[model samples]
Target: MSESNSAGMFSGRKSEGLVLVVDDEPDVRKVVRMTLEKSGYTVLEAEDGEKAIAEMKKDENSLLLSLIITDIRMPNMNGIDVINYYRKEWPSVPLIVLTGFPDMDMATSMLQHGIADYLVKPVEAEKLRSSVSKTLEKREVHGF
Candidate 1:
């Protein structure tokens, strides 16, 4: 695989820290990774929540992840589980949820669990960038 296609690896803007993106779809991961990388952030990707957790555990000893962006549904594990685990294990790391299914109940539940932001599927590049920037800035200001 080319350097760009490597999962759990980063290229460009090392100074910006790392963001973990968990999505079951490879296309979604590619688009999100490219968008963030262009905005001067390094990105790591996992195919599902289980792999995301594994990646987090592996990187915990090395990289200081700045954020997590995850899809709501996936095989093996889902975003809610990922969020819950992170909330307890890595409370300071911010999370953003992206879901094709925008249920009011689900959104409300995720918000109550401390998700930084939520975006529906087919997210525009600019909107994603804005959400990520705002979320990171909020965390910085709050001393997370």
Candidate 2:
């Protein structure tokens, strides 16, 4: 990415930035999208890691992404792969891991990778909102 394009995402001009939600379940995606949209954030959906990467590559708005929330148990392309891709290509965009099967090792590893949050499945709406808010705030202050 170009320096100007990278700067755009962290420009801090917008009140809320676009977020990418990656999960195989449509219902989960819908809930996340609705929750985020209601909180004044624009959101995009992807079924898996591969699709998420494709969307980022193809969509113009993806360049404005401020956050990514991904589920770990997705088929074909899991959250680990998604995290790896993000850390490699867009490490400035903060990530959150939402998983049903939470493992200590995995959470530790993901946290070490600098992910913003690791939330368990069936997360409360308020909790999700709070996490997103806090993560975004941290990004603004820390730029990471």
Candidate 3:
């Protein structure tokens, strides 16, 4: 086999998904899209919870929505609001929070309110991949 084939070469096409990634930072969104796409996930984006919800509502294909990655502090509806909304509307959407500051109180509150997991800002690709994989594999996007 050629050297490229030895690595289990990746497919250029991303997984057919409509994942909602919410964050105020454009750079953060770029990184996430790049990472998730590399892992074969088609990513959807939102600058805040409101936009996220809007995107979710526009979702066709009844996409499984594999997961949602959001930032805790954002304008015009923070991650908390997004989590709360999904809890009622699309109860099956898994949420992972990314924050510049990861406080126990906030984490506890989110967990109590149904957040699947969290990550401190500057989230590494590996961490994102692992968290996403675990969440999707368990197919427990609704439990949180």
Q: How many steric overlaps are in each model, in order?
A: 0, 0, 1
Off by over 4 Å in 3: 1-17, 59-62, 76-79, 140-144
TM-score of 3: 0.77
Clash pairs for candidate 1: none
Error of 1 at 72 (Å): 1.5
TM-score of each: 0.83, 0.81, 0.77
Question: Model 2 over residues 12-92: C-alpha lDDT tens digits?
Answer: 334377788888898888898888767777677888877887778863656677898988775554557767877787778
Residue range with the least summed lDDT across 10 consecutive positions in model 3 = 1-10
In candidate 1 the C-alpha lDDT for residue 40 amounts to: 81
lDDT of 3: 0.70
lDDT, candidate 1, 1-144, per-residue tens: 223433355444353657888888888888898888778877788887667777777734225788989887765545577687667767788889988976788888888888998889888999999999999889889987
Candidate No. with top TM-score: 1
Which residue segments of model 1 deviate by more than 4 Å? 1-14, 59-63, 76-79
